[model samples]
Target chain A: NAGVTQTPKFRILKIGQSMTLQCTQDMNHNYMYWYRQDPGMGLKLIYYSVGAGITDKGEVPNGYNVSRSTTEDFPLRLELAAPSQTSVYFCASSSLAVYFTDTQYFGPGTRLTVL
Target chain B: GESVGLHLPTLSVQEGDNSIINCAYSNSASDYFIWYKQESGKGPQFIIDIRSNMDKRQGQRVTVLLNKTVKHLSLQIAATQPGDSAVYFCAEGPIDHGSSNTGKLIFGQGTTLQVKP
Candidate 1:
């Protein structure tokens, strides 16, 4: 199985531009997450979904939106992208819940640069 | 914002030596803790994890220690190899809200481990 797959491996966005970072998992996991890692900083949670049709905000949900239309896909949308939004974006999924175990598997990552 | 942070910004160790990375979390209600290793140009990989009910857990070559009283967490790697060089992160999960099994995770800044030969 492809575990988790993320699209747009790298992208550069102009200020105020928008884009969507795609994520998909083949593990049939119920929990999906979107996180961004800045230079020398820890990964910050952007949005998460416990299951399809259910989504919620995380610590750094600003400038981002997520929709879980299906179990295999959870996409992150960035609106009016700013320089602050530039970072390495990673999508992850876990067989169990976030609290059940920290054994979430991750996608390669999408590197975004906002100019 | 919830602050789960690493005590050291970076660490350097010999290829065959052991390595220890420490983390400090502020939320006492956090019931779950995890350690992830992120290699260059790759996503974070689960190293090991420890629950609030347990003090330590061991994986293949990695171990996680959780001290709930002081909100401290640590990851130890024995016989570190070059592949072990990466950024290590410690994450915490609050017990309430969302669900007992599924909730948001608060990640620490991260400690970069450099394994030198």
Candidate 2:
């Protein structure tokens, strides 16, 4: 099973341009998350979904939006790309029934550059 | 705001030696801690995790130790190899204050480990 997969492994966008980062998981996880990692730093959550039709903002969700219309797909939208949004974005999924610890599985990652 | 921080930004070790990476968290209420390893151009991968109830957990060639008294967590890699060279991050997750068990994770600044042969 391809635990999780992301589309457009790399992309470059101009300021004000908008695009969506696509993510899908075959594991049928109940939780999905979007995170961005800057150079030499750990990742920070942008948004997350508990299930389809339920989404919540995370630590740094100012410039990003997300939707989980189906259990298999959770896409992140960048409405007005800026230089601050240039970073490696990751998609992860996990099961909530694992009790206190939930091991999140991550996709390869999408590297975005905004100029 | 409460945050997690690493003790070192970079560490270099000779191949076949043991390596230890440390992290200090400000939140004493955090009940779950995790370790992730990321290669040069890849996403972070789960390495190991320990809950507040346990002090130590071992996996393959790695071990995680948690000291609640000082709110410290550490990852130990045994007989480190070239493939073990990567940036390691420690994450803390607190229990959901509400009815649900879902919660967000806070990641610490990564610590890069280099293995020299």
Question: Pick by TM-score: which candidate is best?
Answer: 2
lDDT of 1: 0.89
Point out where model 1 deviates above 4 Å: A97-102, B96-101
Q: Count the backbone clashes (under 3 Å) in each candidate.
A: 0, 0
lDDT by residue for model 2 over B44-70, one digit each (tens)? 899999989999999999999999999
- As for candidate 1, its clashing pairs are none
What are the lDDT figures for the candidates, one per model?
Answer: 0.89, 0.92
Per-candidate TM-score against the hidden true structure: 0.93, 0.97
TM-score of 2: 0.97
Model 2 C-alpha lDDT per residue in residues A35-67, reported as the tens digit of each score: 999988888999998889999988899988888
Worst window of 10 by summed lDDT in candidate 2 chain B = B95-104
Error of 2 at B79 (Å): 0.6
Interface RMSD of each: 3.0, 2.3
Chain B structural similarity (TM-score) per candidate = 0.92, 0.96
Chain A, model 1: TM: 0.95
